[model samples]
Target: MNFIDLFAGASGMSEGFINAGFVPVSHIEMDKYACDSIRTRAVYHYLKENDKEDYYNDYLKGNISREELYEHAPKQILDSVLNIEINDKSIKSIFEKIDKRLGDKEIDLIIGGPPCQAYSILGRHQENIENDPRNKLYIQYGRFLKKYQPRAFVFENVPGLLSAQKGQHFKNLKTYFRKMGYEVYHDKLNSADYGVLQARKRIIIVGWRKDNDHGFPAIEKIKRKFTVNDCFQDLPKLKPGEALKVTPYSLNKNEYLEKYELRNGVDFVTQHIARPHNERDLNIYKTAIKKWNRERVRIKYPDLPSHLKTHKNESSFIDRFKVVDGKGVSHTVVAHIAKDGHHYIHPDIKQCRSISVREAARLQSFPDNFFFEGPRTAAFKQIGNAVPPLMASAIANKMREYLCQI
Candidate 1:
């Protein structure tokens, strides 16, 4: 199958589709860096090669930055980035020429969510969706979908799209899709239920051509629950601050610490990961855990597990680390919240560090092989913003099975 990706932040959906055997034809992205990352490949090859200083000097010594080498990049890299359909006409011209390389292949799937700040819960209260400049991105996506007329489409966003303004915005979106002659099926999915160790919930809407009589196929249930330990237990252990030579494991550590130790620039997650926690947060964790432990002892009911009670007790330490029940689901793995360690943290460790990038990616069910790029901030954002790969894989598998029968 052929596809186009828009608002392709790190190509999460694209990777999922590709793993499911679909070929991505084009992608549109506003962030040059993120575009650069996705443009490279499903993983960071440059980083892997860069570590081998000898290889860089022998083969890439005078070559332009990887971002500038797209014209000469291999077919695989070009498909991921060069065929970009952009907001700028000048850029679009460059992409048209690249499209010629595809010859007569037909595009089959159009997948992506637009710039989603407007649909984010934080953006709604601080910025009005109606007036928010970013809200119109959906219109842009709609225009792209109409022009491409791909047989199938997938739109994803924060759950805020459902309850934002009591559902008025969602209502309008539904009507708009109906007007386009597409059968749209949307629902909020918990990533944990689909194999992600975290409990991220997102609104995923799949639209199919009315003639197909088939929309998104059902996703298989996760075979078993995952936990923080299951995802990160194999990695080398570190006290709050550490780094490793493995590219992915290396990127997972706080960049700032890596920068400070290695003398390079770092991004938000790296800095947060590298930096030690302040006294206030440390104290809060201690207090919270103490209060929670006391409450757990006082409770007599067996229905409520002591592990789940961590959510109810706000004393402080409980927020840092809570036992993740093997039989239950996990909390959403948000980015850069390591400072607070509230979202996902080590259940056994008492340290200030939040789960590392590798840990978070694992919780998101990203394959250990899928590498990331940019500073710590970019890495964290990409991981946090992505559709859990395992979830997408399951969905894609089901869709493939159903389509074969058709």
Candidate 2:
């Protein structure tokens, strides 16, 4: 069956559905960089169109100064202006194209994780208010459901979505979707239970169309936890800065970066290049590593934090990136790992070195053959933010069982 992935960032959700044997018919994304990483069945062309138009207008129109354009331009005139110019299409036309593709054939599901950070409980706490403009994007998702009338839909977001302000917003969301003729279930699910080897808990909202008699599946208990040893026990090991000859299992560097030139011969950068740290910084990193080792020993022998009790090998305090066992399942991968290597350390050594791109991918449960095609940070972000393909596949199987009851 076919499915449309909306707000598809790097196709993490799409990867899950594909693993579950569903075909992705289209994807809607605005970020050019992220779009480059995952091939889209379809994309919202309007964003690129407007951006191109805006660039050309800004550069070619010598008649209008930038300051004058910014200050004196009428609101109506600005509204008419395309940010990226392409006259070939609009959003409505794109949706129509999708509808044409869906004609006669049945699509089993529609899935996405719209940028829901604005409404996230963490965002609310940090921002000190609930005025995130992104919060309203769910309305757009709702509008899509009303229009397409898919058999089922899944909305994924941070766990904070369920606990934010005692879930008033979540209540409203359920009521609205229920009003739209769907029986919806929203709960936080731990990725580790589904072989992610991470402690991440995301809020997943699964729903069936009102016309359908499908009942939601009960959450099943997984007898075993996916561990670092389960995932990477078989891949060939590579040391820091050691580039492997173009292998079937490697990923290419991102095409959007200007700093590193990708020659035709070399497909990927082996690891993140490092710079020399000052003496004091080096000392601090050493101390952090020592402290981390001590913590690990203590946890293994005695009282341990709940988060670390079951994940002793994955708990590298210096930077969690290190694979404690070089040939084992990886620890929980987080988005912030891209910004700093503080959470990841080399699995083989105790130095404060960051994990290689390949190592990071393994940690996120990406198959060795699955490549990321953006800048380093973008690649890491994609890995960090994605739903582990294995975990997603398990969830999809459950969804199928849930739909069978209809």
Candidate 3:
């Protein structure tokens, strides 16, 4: 049950596996901010597990800073994040500590995805398709497979990975793993199908050692569909530029909300701060909402109120400002939100602002108790880049069930 997480951005995949009863010996990430978030999570895990109730109480009362809590975290967990490339000599430290942390157990699982921009189909054209250096990071993953030889591994990336090079890249990827003695099952999995409200389509590759017979888990259609409303409806409404640092979540138990509840039983949520919008964008949001309500459906660009049709690039950015209908599955939450959230305008016209970091996190299926540590934009980047914890939980559950039998 011991695992190593690579390319562990904010430890989203690690969170899911750990929640499913797997133990992580180390989480390797390169970004300092992301590593801090993962380390903070480890601190929370330590506090919760070691029965340090008073420390948490002190934290809430502002008697001790978050830095003080880190002092109490186990060194093994604090060292969990190595902010360096996998090939760097720094990786030696993780190998040095693995035996001490895991004892007699071999590494059972390896989970993560490489940086995906070069493999994304949308960002490529004829000249740059094969020239992206990030495309070579798969070799780093393969290196881990050869060294650790885990019982199973999970690799995630954008769906475009399938078509990266006229299908040759995918074929070669499978062939390489097969040579490593793994039976691989690779496919595009939509997060919405696995209970995440966001319609994120990621390529998930699950591999088992040749001797194991576990096929990928069955995909079942959900009876009760989750939507933008289901995820964000309960949050307090906000106007442009308004922000609330902390607010209480209304306790409501539904299958969806249960997965997103605060695990520590904390009543308040942090990072609910909203971003300010210029007058031009606010007017556009107002028009988008007013027009959509009137039409009771999607509002085309040409039909937008004339005053809002000032942009010259109508055809290219036609529906640039989108208001997600609360009743429908949310549009994919992408890292572009870090630059500007115009692509994901709040569904509520009264708010008249872009989606906040916390709202984006909700759409991404991060648990209410989990905190992203950084600037607001950094938080958005972390959430946008993460795997939805609930969706990841489903995958880990199936993987664990099979691993136990083996």
Top lDDT model = 3
Candidate 3 Cα lDDT to native: 0.78
Q: What are the lDDT scores of the predictions, listed in order?
A: 0.58, 0.56, 0.78
Clashing pairs in 1: 254-270, 255-270, 256-270, 285-317, 288-315, 288-316, 288-317, 289-317, 289-318
User: Model 1, poorest ten-residue lDDT window?
Assistant: 260-269
Candidate 1 global TM-score:
0.73
Q: Per-residue lDDT tens digits of candidate 3, residues 276-369?
A: 8888778878877776666656556776667767766667556677776667778888877888877788777777788888888888878766
Which run of 10 residues does model 2 get worst, by summed lDDT?
256-265
- TM-score per candidate: 0.73, 0.69, 0.91
How well is each residue in 1-406 modelled by candidate 2, as lDDT tens digits? 6677777776767777766667666666665555655531111112133443342233222344433433433332222211221112455655666676567776677888767566553466566556665655666677667777788998888877766567787787888888777889777777766655556677888889877755555657554433453443333455434444233323333221111111122223233333234444344445444544555421121233343333445433424323243333345576766676645655433444556566666555555445465667777777777776656776787777666666
Off by over 4 Å in 2: 40-93, 119-122, 229-285, 297-332, 404-406
**Runs with alpha carbons beyond 4 Å of true place in candidate 1:** 42-76, 82-102, 245-275, 286-329, 335-343
Q: Which structure among the candidates has the greatest TM-score?
A: 3
Q: For every candidate structure, what is the RMSD over all alpha carbons to the true structure, in angstroms?
A: 8.7, 12.0, 2.5
Evaluation by lDDT, superior candidate among 1 and 3: 3
Clashes of 3: 0
lDDT of 1 by residue, 42-161 (tens): 324434434633332222223345544443345555555643435545444644653664567655677787666567755766744677756555666666567656676788888988
